[model samples]
Target: MTWSIVARDPETGAIGIAVASRFFAVGARVPFIAPGTGAVATQALINPLYGPRGLALLRGGAGAAEVVHALVADDSGRDHRQVQVMDARGRFAAHTGTDCVDWCGAIADDLCGLAGNMLAGPQVLEETARAFRENAALPFPRRLLVAMAAGEAAGGDKRGKQSAGLVIHGTEDWPDLDIRVDDHPEPIAELARLERVSRERWVHFKRYLATGADPVGITDRARIDSEIAAAVAAAQAQDAGEPAAGKAPAA
Candidate 1:
């Protein structure tokens, strides 16, 4: 029903997932990630339960393998299930239920996971892992999209592609990225284009909100620095000379 990869870059603390399927809007159902938390990919007969449960386990300090074991143990339908998990610590794990459709399997690598069902062969997952591991020049989302494209080229979802998705949830100061190509003729390619445009739009919005201070019109750094210095001076002025370290100031 679905195939995906969940991964985190140890150097950047950036978590990402890439997946594709014959199903419509694969993005809407398979991948889940929280900036500082972790990532999960739930597919193969598609159990939505694993999304929140996996996240909860990771947030509670469970490692990737531990969470996968717990989830599989708890599910009576383990053989029909496929899932991949990577924690914030970059630990990785994956599962391919025995009952998954033909040509289905997964590959869990150092910092990434790849899975697929109804693929041309095991090469789908292999290509995904190879593309991700070998590409050092691309951003996280683009890397993900490239890996997915590689998977598709390697005979993805044997039934052919119908939908694709990319999701990234980060800090409040950073906008979250979520894109979907549902029922598109060439989903992965379209998804990549959408990602590029969306990223540009985000940059545009950020630029438009600039405070007219820096060369790029960002926040007024000089003014802010001056204000903070003034506040510090005022606090120092309220203090008596040579106050004891660690002692409260006299009222």
Candidate 2:
């Protein structure tokens, strides 16, 4: 019914989940994240409690493997549940119930977690993990989309795609990026388009939103506009393979 990738950005310490499924609004139910804790994606015959409950455990200092173990051990539906977790320290764990549908399972390493049920084949997850490792240079959010697209190309959701979502958390309580497609003919492509649109302003503007360290964040509209303009200009330059104004190209 779904496939997802949970990952931590090595450079920025951001954590994220990318999910696509035949299920309606899969994003609303799976993929739970808390910036200071970790991330969880619970599916298969999912027990939604795992999302919040698992995050609580991570916040309380449990590791990924420990959280997975605790969540499964206490559930009567354990035999049908599929879950994967990544802790703040980057430890990872996955569980696929004994009774999950064929082609359903999970894989995890410190760098990422890939899990799915009702998938076209194991390659759905394999290709996702491969792209994730190979595309480390992509911006964190775009890297997740690229990795998930590789999974879809490998034959995602045996039933076909209906919805897709990407949720990312950096060093803040709220998401750095969150976008979902509840229903779409080509969900992943639609998701990509939405992400592109968000960059025009939301991506640049979010930097001014209130954060833990700054309760009243960047109230000056003129300064905010200036930063957004500069950010837009820099992004445009980077996209054109030119250095940002007054900035040197990467060596």
Tens-place lDDT per residue, model 2, 28-146, is 88999989679999999989999999999999999999999999999999999999999988878999999988799888765799999999999999888887787777788778888
Q: Write the residue-wise lDDT of candidate 1 on 1-251 in tens digits.
A: 66787776555666777677899878888987856878888888778999999999999999988989988999999999888888877777888899999898777757587878878898888877777776655557777777777777778888877998887755432335677888988888888778757643452344334342543444666665565566555545653442222111221
* Pairs of residues at least 3 apart in sequence or in different chains that clash in candidate 1: none
Off by over 4 Å in 1: 172-175, 203-251
The window of 10 residues in a row where model 1 has the poorest summed lDDT is 242-251
**In candidate 1, how many Å is residue 180 off?**
0.6
Look at candidate 2 and tell me the lDDT of residue 107: 81
Best by lDDT: 2
RMSD of each predicted structure: 15.6, 4.8
TM-score for each of the candidates = 0.78, 0.94
- How high a TM-score does candidate 2 get? 0.94
